[model samples]
Target: MRLLSRPLPAALTIGLVAELLFCWRLTTPHMLVFDEVHYVPAARMLRDLAGPVNIEHPLLGKTLIALGMLIFGDGPLGWRALSTVAATGVVVGVHAMLWQIFRRVRTANIGAVLALLNFTVFIQARIAMLDGFMAAFVVGGLAMLLWAMRSEGGAVWRRWLGGAVLLGLAIGTKWTALPYLGMAGAAFLLVRRRHPDLWPGLPALAGLALLGGAAAATYFATFWPAFLYADQPLTLARLLPFQIDMYHQQTQVLPPHTYQSNWWTWPFDWRPVWYLYEPADGAQRGILMLGNPVVMWGGLVAVIACLIAWARGRDARAGGIALLWIASVAMWALIPKSLGFYYYYYLSSIWLALVIAAAFDHWRDRLRYWDEAFLAASAVLFIHFYPILSAAALRGPQSFHGWMWLKSWI
Candidate 1:
């Protein structure tokens, strides 16, 4: 219990720092950038007139964006304010999740710092996107699941039900979040088997039903806005067709994008997607949604090390992180689509950070200050990539060229 509560300040501190980093000069690119063009207007329509827009995705994220716009008067900062808040929650959630699973304050703190140093987390936090909201909810759900696993029978359902609600919200934000729900279900069954006393008379099937039912109910509730705003009367017959249309729209192939890289290329940082690039006379700006190489590549290595630890010594923490990373990565690979972006690796990257943290916890006893050194190096890399990550104007073409490690990144 102390371990759970002790990290509250650490989580808040990480979140506060992330908000500052993300919110600094938040209105620089005064207009819509990248996917903001798609979702922000939808948000505006929703907030202004309760109209349906971007029906392919769920409404909660856009609703949050709409709420921000309504409260803040629809500036660049207004559009992104909720994203910034969600990103901060993600940082805080990562700290809580890591501490819950690993029970090491230093390891948890390191994972949270690693998250801030991660370019995708930092950049996605600043932009108006569903991915940030999904990431925050995913982390929060995972943390809640861990808390449930640690609880007695009396509190287990409440904790697990809370986790299910968050995961459902995650799914409502993006369908990609569905895999995490599956993972949570499997984990719940495991907890039931291993800790039968914790479940009392509840069977695993009944427990899973309760969890999944809660998630399904929450997801169905998130569609209320769409139902209310549709031209036709609200009915399952009407909604089913719209859902089918959305699915078809998503899966259909489109023209090639310059930064469209496969899931395999993400961990390698092969091609960084340029979300925004402007070459105006006095206002050259760019935002490349790529992971920091030091952290990304190093996280890949940590995944391997964690796998080795799991294979050789049956390290549960190591194994859990490695399995989670593999599952997250594999989920993208299994997506039956011709197009995917580097940011598709966002969920996997969070698990990789956990792998790095678990390995750090192991190595801290044997190798002194290596964890600290890694964090320091990661911070330096974040600084080096800030210009491109934050869309800051370059002094010249050469200033931009200096940061491009590969021609694909250009």
Candidate 2:
């Protein structure tokens, strides 16, 4: 229990356990789920020097998936193993960021645990999808930013550059990372403007250059053929057109599936996509797609609480973290993208953890009975939904109903 007294050790232990849990069902039912079909094939093509095809996403995530294929063969487990690792990386990165922000060992530990208990993170971590990787890179970038904010002089420059590099890596994983980069940059600029005497222009320039260089390197490294065929006889005139075409394809409507839903309904959790397993057979045989009702509902309340706290200037750290979380999720709502799903809330889980951590902090000095009761309740909810989240065999419809607290979940 002494480990709990130190945030870093506690976060590391929690991250390791989360990673193990994510990897456990990595190969269940042994088949492609959702977008894995597109990604797996693209990864296979990556192994061969086949001409670059029109893939909507950036190359880093597919590159990571390709790495898994190279190591474990082009199988379900191989493609998904990396996702489990990335998911764990996210948990670890979030822990580091929280510890840095709150400077409280218990708050950081609670944040990591809340992330583990989040059904969305757990389910997505176990699947062969890009969200987990996206989460990792995003959190990694945030952690570096926090480090930069906390450091001094040359150390600050180094951390700032590292944060920029990770931000590029995050963009490589998903385009959504761009908004976060913009937000972080704006925040940095405001901070710099407030204390120009403390900021170094040369270091800031160097960090920006390093970030741009890393992004360019990673971009071409993954898509070397684009550079090689730049002037070839059969080469496409430019990469931009090909990218546009790919974007169109991804955004366009596709064949009806059980979970395909409109973006408007996603926030309400109207329909969640089932990413894996033999659904036709029985409950125990498949992984059900769902988010934790407690976290999801609690997050909504937290969002409101966060706004009020920020308005009152009470607990600025908690309020600021909550605001960052809300901004990240709000991007999805503003985007014109089609077919958003519950898993898209992966980034929102960070905010969810923040809310839960803030709540714990509020109760920390209260009567022990309240604290014990809340902890016990959270544990029960986590255990109750563990089976469906992990794809463990369930009794039948009864099992599906265990976590399907809302009619919308079906």
Candidate 3:
């Protein structure tokens, strides 16, 4: 029988297997990590509110978390399931985006592999947080937007609309997604300005309108608490004020958190927040936080390579996308936000992966040997750090040493 004739490739199969195993391991020590205490509570309150509490963040991620709570009963698995699924979606989205960009199966597979092996993506996915979901939606939206750009058909409007809606969802997931949307808008204007014949202004305007409208409606709908309070004619006036108060609450720096650090320290991978644990139970207690060091450090080289390639115009598409990612990641540095952590570097990882994948794609033909060597090295490093990064069992000093790489990390 040819039923299994076209089985999945080794790389894809391995990646999927790793993701599943990691998910299982991650779910093991499922206590609320980091800001999850805030998000999970907010999600619980969402059901009770007539309007949203006006938290600085949009509601898509919280909504999904709520869904998981509904299904899984608000346990660690229930709260984190959504994040895991979203992380998986990010892997798929990266693959789909690469496929659209390179128009080759191998390129897409490579991109997906790199993303799966990414420490930030892996660590963030297993927790009950909004970053993974935001990354997924933003990357997914980018994939759709790229497809729309490449497509040449009468139904292109549908593709454009899909991209816009996804972009809106991305914003709903995280405010950080706004920069990507702006980039998309800028890219559209540049592309349209250059070739007016290919992309008309009307469609672009319509697409933006649809995106903005959908996003606004979704945002308001998620604020159930605000609406309920606004039900009374007199209380309606206080609705906006209530929302403003919530925003203030999110931005306000309360007491000091052990993990809190300045944005400047993030890029160096300093101050990673401990998200989950089951105590040191001799060994095999399982830890569930921290990104892989190999991928994070190696990305530095890839970032440099991408800059050179983009500067030389050798891989303009790859360069442009990398720049977009960098711009988004750099926003944290530019902002005046008081509280920051290593995980905030998630967007930076996305940029790094794109650049790395682009470099690999560009040099695959010219430097096959180097590509193979780098891939092997990356794999080994990821494996080496897997136990510590994922919080698997380790002896006393070894476990402590794992986190002692930098003074700031401690």
Candidate 4:
């Protein structure tokens, strides 16, 4: 069979298939699972003009969920429909970024496939949460950034402007995306130094100001719902108190969660968080937030290889991905809050998928069957763990025993 090598067709196929997989019986376990309790209710509040819910984080993610719920009745499928779509967007966006930056159709297709198979995204896609939406926008912004670097004059500036807006949307969805925005600005400066002809006479400061201003404006605009509250006037004075509360809410130490883990242990997948585990009428269901071991472990090797390659000879793509992974993990280290979770690695996992794709391209000729074999193994692991990932009913309590390979996973 001839493979689909065209970027749009390939990406769209990946996205559609993923969405179907995610949406299949999406209403199963017919109750709020994991963070759904937090966001879904918050979305309903926004839809019905109730007071702000989950104000610690920004509102766009919940607003999108609310949009879906408003259209469809507020049920499992309704709250999660937007998440399903955004997760699909992440696949397409990453595929576009890979295709545009490397211009290698084979590599880009493999990258998209790897992303779909990776459980970090796969699990999040099935649930109603902010991480999937944030990841989508990050990929979208990066795709735009890469597209801008390859263009000339007005095209370049337009893509940059669009990229800034998307990144701002990401930040509005979750504050964790801020480091990525800063890294994007740094990357812009580096690329501009090399390709001065892209925007010939534009001052670097002026260009940065434009991008920053656009991003800031985009972020502020997402707060329109907050401004429109009946008693709260649409004035800066009212916004300041909400902003202060939001800041304190995020920084203040909260009661400990059983599943919390430090940033150091995330790459190892040492401790998996159980987002939902409920004993129902007939049987028990679960949604264990975990990464596919094959992808997580194999991708780590690829990350090391990319860093080595970048150090030997400056491979801009490899260097940029490595820096992004580092930045995503590093920001958590500096944050005052002591609690962190595995899901915080969502942004870095995109690079991990890229690392696997790069490894495939790097070693395809040397070891013809390795990439294909790795893909097969990844698919098998995903299937083996699907029951837990999707909150599917277990035959018995012992059903989860074998899958918990790590004691910490229990």
TM-score of each: 0.94, 0.86, 0.84, 0.95
- Report the lDDT of model 1 for residue 201: 49
Ranking by lDDT: 1, 4, 2, 3
Query: Which structure is stronger by TM-score: 3 or 4?
Result: 4
Pitting candidate 2 against candidate 3, the one with the higher lDDT is 2
Q: How does residue 168 of candidate 3 score in lDDT?
A: 72
TM-score of 1: 0.94
Off-target runs (Cα >4 Å) in candidate 2 are: 193-222, 225-237, 250-258, 262-268, 277-284, 362-375, 396-399
Candidate with the greatest TM-score versus the true structure: 4
> What would the per-residue lDDT of candidate 3 be over residues 1-410, giving only the tens digit for each residue?
23212223433464465469557765555456667888888677564443444367766687788788898887877788778778877877777777777776656665676777777787877777788888887888888777776566644666766776777777767767777777878777776666565433346676667656765565455444335433332155665675576567657876777777776655556677666444543454434345556556666676777778778856766777677767866788765466776777786776666667777777677767665566677677678767656766666543655556777655
**Quality of model 1 by C-alpha lDDT:** 0.82
Model 4: weakest 10-residue lDDT segment is 226-235
Off by over 4 Å in 1: 1-5, 195-203, 230-234, 279-282
Question: What is the per-residue lDDT of model 4 for residues 268-356, given as tens digits with 9 covering 90 to 100?
Answer: 88888888777754678777888888988887888887787678857767666766677777788887676888888877777777877
Those runs of model 3 whose alpha carbons end farther than 4 Å from true positions after fitting are 1-19, 47-56, 195-202, 224-243, 254-256, 277-289
Model 4 residue 171 CA deviation in Å: 0.9
lDDT of 1 by residue, 1-410 (tens): 45334687767777788899989988878888889999998888777655667877877888888888888888888898888888888878878888887888888988888988899888898888889999898999888877776677668788878888998999988888988999878866775676676545456887789778998888878777665664443467766677687688778888998778888788888888888878643678888888878788999888888888878877767777788888898888677777888888888777767888988876677757898899999999999889888878888655778788888888
lDDT head-to-head 3 vs 4, winner: 4
